[model samples]
Target: MGNKNISMAVIRRLPKYYRYLADLLAKDIQRISSKELSEIIGFTASQIRQDLNNFGGFGQQGYGYNVEALHREIAKILGLDKKYKAILVGSGNLGQALTNYSGFKNAGFDIMAVFDANPRMIGLKIRDYEIMDSDLIESFVSENNVEIAILCIPKEGAQQVADRLVKSGIKGIWNFAPVDLDVPSSVIVESVNLTESLFTLSYLMKDGEEA
Candidate 1:
C-alpha cells in the first residue's frame, strides 16, 4: 500500500520519466527490465519495481516491462495526455521568451493568453496570442475557461498576482518570480527559479556536486 501511495506520488517526477522515456522511445528501445531501468534512471531495481507496480508493471518473472507501454502510462498520469490551456502574466523578457517558446505548446501545454498593463505591450502579439490588459484577467480567464496560469511578474507582485489568479478560477499556477506566494490552499502553485539552478550548477562545477 505504501508503494502504491509512492507511485501516486509519481506525479512529482513526471518530467524525469518523460525525458528518459522519450530518449528510449527515440532509440527504438522496446522492453526493459526493472534492473535495466534502474541503471538508466539511477534508481535501485527494487525502487523501480515498486514505483512501477502501482499502475504499470510488465516484467515477466525473468524478463521486463515493455518500455512503450510504461511511457504512455506515465504520460497519462502526468496530465500530459491532454492539451492544457494556459495564461501568461507579464510581457517582460522572461514572459515573452516563454510565450515564444515552441516547446510549451509542443509539450501539450499551450499559452493561450498573455497579460500585461504596459500600454506599449498590451496590443503586442506573442506566440499568436496578443497581450491583454491585466485588468481583464478575470473576464478573459472566465470566458476562455483557462486552467493554467504562468506568472512572470516581479517578486513584490507575486502574492498579489497569486491572489488575482486564485480569484480568476485558475486551477494551477507556474510562477517564475523569485518570491513565495500566499493564497487559498485550493490552488496549486509551481515556482521555478532559473538563477538559483544556474548558480547551483556553477557551484557544483566549481566544487563537487551536492544533492
Candidate 2:
C-alpha cells in the first residue's frame, strides 16, 4: 500500500532515518554506509537496510547511500515537501500565541487565517493575519486552500466548531479544547490537552524531579 499502511514498529524508525540523514547532510557527507548509519542511530545494520528496503532501495552493495537523496526522500514521506496551510479557529490567548509563533512556518506549516465569533475581535489584526468571523470559514478555506486547523475554543464550542470545520473541507485538525471530537474517517485529528499534560507532569514531579 502506501506510507499510511506502514506499521508502527517501522514508523518509529523514521525519525532515526531522518536524524542521521540530516546530520550527514549538514556535515557535507555525500554518502553513508549502512553499518555506519546503524552505529549512529543505534540500530543493527540489517535493520537499517530492511527499513530502507521497505520504503524502496536506498543503497548499493559496495558503495552505500546518497545522504542528500535519503534526506529528501524521508522529508517527502513525512509530508514536509509541501507546506500545509492552516487556520486558527479560536483567536483567543492561546490561538493568538500560535499566530505570533513564527516557528511553524519553518516546519512547513503556515497559519494563513484565524476565526472568532465576537464582532469586536473579528477584523482585528494579530501578527500578520487578520481575524475573520467563523461565518466565513468555508469560503476562506476554499479560497486559501487551507487544509488544517487548530481549535482553541471553549469545550462547549469545540464540537460545534469541529462540525463546521469538517464541512469546511479541512483534512486535519489540532484540537486543544479538552474534548474528544468526532469527525469523518477521511479527516485526522490530533488532541493536545495542555492542562492535563501539565497536571500529569506535576504529579510525576511531586517528589521533586526524577532522581
lDDT of each residue in 129-211, candidate 2, tens digit only: 88898899888887877899999899998988888888878899999999999998899998999999999989889857655
Query: RMSD to native for every prediction?
Result: 3.1, 3.2
Candidate 2 deviation (Cα RMSD): 3.2
TM-score for each prediction?
Answer: 0.87, 0.79
Name the runs in model 1 displaced over 4 angstroms.
1-4, 7-10, 56-58, 202-211
Error of 2 at 126 (Å): 1.8
lDDT of 1 by residue, 1-211 (tens): 2233554356566678668888999999988888887898897889777766665565576868777887888887677889988999999999999888999888889888899978899898876888899999888888888999999989888788788878879889998998878867778788898889999989988786444
Q: What's the lDDT for candidate 1?
A: 0.82
* Clash tally for model 2: 0
